[model samples]
Target chain A: MTVLDIPSGIPAHVDTPAPGDPRLARLSLNQRTTANWDLREAVEGAVAAGLPAIGLWREPVAEVGVDVARRIVDDAGLRVSSLCRGGFFTASDRAERTRAHEDNLRALDEAAGLGTKALVLVPGGLPAGDKDLAGARARAAEAIAALVPAAVVRGVTLGIEPMNPIYAADRGVISTLAQALDIAEQFAPHEVGVVVDTFHLWWEPGVYAQIARAGERIVSYQVCDWITPLPADSLLARGMMGDGHVDFPAFTRAVAAAGYTGDVEVEIFHADVWAAPGDQVIATMARRYVELVQPHL
Target chain B: MTVLDIPSGIPAHVDTPAPGDPRLARLSLNQRTTANWDLREAVEGAVAAGLPAIGLWREPVAEVGVDVARRIVDDAGLRVSSLCRGGFFTASDRAERTRAHEDNLRALDEAAGLGTKALVLVPGGLPAGDKDLAGARARAAEAIAALVPAAVVRGVTLGIEPMNPIYAADRGVISTLAQALDIAEQFAPHEVGVVVDTFHLWWEPGVYAQIARAGERIVSYQVCDWITPLPADSLLARGMMGDGHVDFPAFTRAVAAAGYTGDVEVEIFHADVWAAPGDQVIATMARRYVELVQPHL
Candidate 1:
């Protein structure tokens, strides 16, 4: 019923000693990469694979109850690198704004319970039928400001994600790292920070400059490759690490220089990877992480 | 087989007199919006619809022979507003770069031959297996510099399109109007300028500032809406005017304020629109333009 009760098996991959391996200590698999696994299994899978950490989604945390989920991972000696998400606060209606605020408060609590200081925030897209992007962005800033007190109380850093502009209409209105920083700068770095996801920000020519500018405000560094002939469904196009066009070495160097000693989380959202067995997926992810990304770190 | 020989029929839409209407004079339908139509037909269709201008694509012009294409539009009393495209300069290898340069030279010549003063340039994406976006962008700048002399000689203004960041990987590396201006500002506005397409730029927070920054450097003002459930093929997701989330009134006002008095070309790249009758498609586009976009102008 829990990751703590499961027997620890030798990892199929990562055959070398886990405790002493510097590479294994820095790698984290965001649980959505293995969407089929529940919270307990995800914790056990990461631990068994000799991975030091697992990034969590609120859905699984809510399903098992946050306390139980937190205890499960804690007992397995796995850290929750970052909580999956918390912001979608571009609502114009009073009731909707209140609901979003309540949800984010719960999300901050959940992140705190899991002991993951970072809570990723995908600032919501346009309000229904609204073409005023400027207005929507102002609302997002207000929502973030409103939630900051709660976030600070829970000891959670709200990591605002600057999604690719393609998602500007239907997803996040925070469309560039610079824009994220613009909002994040209003609060202290501990209260509000930036999520540097390579898949979203890699296309930007000035991304490196922004990464360096992020400096101590960089809460998390998420990696996934950008391959094309993208899936008909845009959400599933995040390819495995080395399978796409990202310059991982450059990204790692920039983040390292930015003074972020945080765990590097591989948060992929693809259908094929989700369909595979969790262990196989972890093995493949680990191998790719070692070959393609670990050297950069 | 040529649009030149096809009989000119009465347009199904735009029954009103054309000369006195400012909106009709300012409107132009980009040839790709009616992808199935040939050069002569696009010219004839615009003429029949009482539209004063048509945006020409190099392929259609080449199919009819550039001289013939020019004569056909000239005879129909329709102005060639702007040529569809010319840049794909971001190549890593010398041979490929040479090929791209040569092709762009031909494109500049074609724009000149078609009597369109502005040739739209989609400065290309990353080189094959290349993760160096900064390198690709630098190459694009160099390519533009190389091509500007030929452009000036041909009396063609290179209109660099700042495509949506979604296309930054595969189609156009120039992803922001600001970035386009950075490259364009190095040369005279006449030698290098910006193509302000609503579909490509509507999501940017600083677009209004950039548009004002463009000023006389704005060579063309193209319009299309950003609809959702984007075609799996990102290239075809460009919805017709007013069909999606873009604030056309705001976009029209911005360009007008920026002092661009050029034709407002309606350019949609949807599969359904492409599959329909060109005349019917033109009718719907014209209707949408008059209803949603024409008001601001």
Candidate 2:
């Protein structure tokens, strides 16, 4: 209803800007946001809503059978912008790491089959029973190096998502976009660039400069508003746009200006949001993303 | 107890360096880590544990006269290393910011009265309904500048505690140690440095290098461990010493090598740890800090 305030550099998409349904405008769904959401329902909803991209996870794809997931995605005319994740590469044992590399190869195969742009990665957290973060990072780099050739053959760039430090213990040790990008460049220039997710990165001291530096290499960007005083074991409690104090409008605007024309996907992980009807949650996010987030284009 | 293969380079303090009770180390109790462990009980526990310092909060002091709190700390020979917090400096309105400046002065008086070395700061999250993080940080700096002289007069450095990104929305905007030190240098080097808590900053990308860079400017140091997929709200779920995967030995070594000789306080916030008796919690922490943390010293 209000004039769309999409940031300066983005296209109006005026021809289909609102299309009377915000769902039609943004079609990507981040699988991890609401951990409890059913994978099948997610796919059906994306199809029903005319979303163009549906991010897939290796576990879900494997569980659902790649063919079935591939059929669903292809039939829905959805582009798999990214796979849920690959790369908990740090391991104390060589056998586990080799197994991981083989598993990653399988993941690459799955991604090629699904036709996603990049395998979104959360390079492993601190190694089990060990406390060498720098060493864990080195192990992650070595794992990435081991997998790069397979990824190249698969024709995909590995998107390294730098998670927030709150997860530095067990989630992913790569905790900054700059750190991720630096490591990414060391391996291969076009092969990697950091995946800038607002939830993981909004608080990063030099987030803006990193985004500007990312430029075309960014390729994939994710959005989730940050909420504070998070419940211990913070599996949920993410705020919807405009609710939390995150500067989403400026956040999206910066990267978009940096030339990432991909979808500004909405990713939420609030327990409240997950418990609600999926459609209702998506509807709310779609509306807000268009209203507040779209304003920054 | 059998000697676990302790990482080398750390000194041995595990032989009960103090006396009969191994339960008298953790130099202070962080109020935020324990709910309902009020100012009086906290100080009493500190005195019993032979703790030299305490991290106090404003609310408890307000409820029970500041004069009373001040006397208890001094009488017990306990130092108020740093006031719990002050610096929700992010505000959309100028009036609110000006009021924050006024509150900061009052905090300065409180710090002076308690003879605290520093006033811990949790710089405000984003401006209300605004999306400019840089701007919010600028406002925080301005507020610090306005309040620095008052802090200087009292010989209290506004100890900036760079909280984790999980707190970027509601609690603090200062998300990294390097940025905080930069802000300290810019505004008033002598008036500010930082309160380095491994809990909040361990995952910082360039932390090791920054610790060395921070040099003698680190006014305080704290520790707690992070668990992954951090609690939906991470206010709780902090791991105790030797509990979580934090490389505490390496962390303290970095700080100590950086020329810091301050106390290595264990600041935990797990529900499991706090549910037990306060005395019991302090005893375990003190014992563990000696066995585990002191080695890294």
Candidate 3:
């Protein structure tokens, strides 16, 4: 049995299960869920809600120096679940690709500093005016392979997140978990893995099989519901869990069966959720995560 | 070598190939490209442009009465390349599914009456408020199996078209050419086949291999460019060929190598294209088809 690698900060009391509440112990609130919350506030918010971990985004971590951000999460007694992002590695131009490599190295340092082993990578979309999807995908795979050594040195697992195919043009090209695993498989699971996000993948057929194939390579399992009449910009329509069409029970169960004993980061990206008070959002996220997803986990 | 299936209506003068124009001979103007044109007008337009065939939609065909529509094309010496669509087999309810089956029966009759051997099928998306994508897909497969008998009797090949993943929720459940081929493989190639549309499938990885895998089961090959910064409603933003990012040369070459010797239907759905004068739209479509796609074919 793979034991859940609990991150840095869980108070002694919280570590001991609270009567029948073992499921809540795995919850992590991704900072972007409350978009307006700064690093300190988000850490405090997760702590107040008894969430064991907090997923950090680069923007928030950078706002307060990385060291300060680390200190804030450490002080609040919350472990970092995973870093928000660290990719855009689909450029053919040598100069542009080198710049991306430089940016990824800094992202690795930030992830290591934040005390999270997982750095979620969103391999970028088509290069400007380039119509060769096959070529772009080839470049992304090469970039990931190239970054593996640097990622390993920092003790950070590069979690390649295969985004929705809808974003295959402007946002990302890795649009299926199988595709992500194909790239991640080239490296040791500890060096490179995948982030299984429900919102981006619910429509995919054979996802459960792919999840099983992901196995130890699943570095993180993020949850967010997919609501329809998708926003004109589908990227911003990720709904709160249980508020949309995703079947949480099936998803959480599949992840658990795959032996993923890690934080269930609730990473919603919706405008309405962003507008709500951070505390309220955290509370709602925690409640829904427990009610809708916890039983299956 | 599979001989190119040239449909009727080539004027004797046009049949004798002009130097360097053998590839353009297979072009079929899908009526939707000139959305303002009725059956008679579309037939006239195709003849005026020296085109041999027209792809008709059921709605416009129904308006003229299928018999009249067939007569119009026949009298104008034009052949019906393929019927627009006839599938929505994702419904879980028995009664709704039965209705879809009935509609498909009528569609087969229309295709037979119009003298087209192919019927394009856009399997419907998720049932209302349902999240079981796997279940919906299974239902679609079953529905296709059930319809095969009727389709066979009418000598109409059902061409299952895999739509873009972006439309997986509300428009179609089959999101890749591989998925469509999986369903099509169960029946004889003449009984069931697949539609290869560049607009709906350009972003897919390994598409060329899938096209080759499609082989003789490729009932129809449709072309429409995928323009980005997609309109609020993406369904209506399909650009004219060469106006978007699709690499037509590669797609056409792959289809040709697969031995698909049938009509290449220009099927743009853009609002701007729809609003243009029918003759002008047909003129532009013919030009783009020749300039951007014919060479590879």
Give DockQ per model, in order: 0.65, 0.60, 0.46
Model 2 over residues B105-187: C-alpha lDDT tens digits? 88888877877777888897776567677888888878877788788888888888888777776667788988888888875
Better of 2 and 3 by TM-score: 3
Worst 10 contiguous positions by lDDT, candidate 1 chain B: B1-10
TM-score of each: 0.94, 0.87, 0.91
Off by over 4 Å in 3: A1-23, B1-23
Write down the lDDT of every candidate, Cα atoms only: 0.85, 0.73, 0.84
Query: Model 2, clash count?
Result: 15
Residue B52, candidate 3: C-alpha displacement in angstroms: 2.4
True contacts kept of each: 0.70, 0.94, 0.49
In angstroms, the error of model 1 at A9 is: 26
Q: What level of docking quality does candidate 3 show?
A: acceptable
Ranking by DockQ, best first?
Answer: 1, 2, 3
- Tens-place lDDT per residue, model 3, A1-297, is 222211111122212223236566889989898889888888887877778889999998999899999999888888899998989988879899999999999999999988899999999988877888888889988888888999999999999999887788777888899889988888899999999999878877789999999999999999998776776656677887766678899988999999998999999888777877787677667667767777788
Residues A132-186, model 1: lDDT tens digits: 8999999999999999999888899999999988889888998999999999999
Prediction 1: B-chain TM-score: 0.92
Worst 10 residues of 3 chain B by lDDT: B4-13
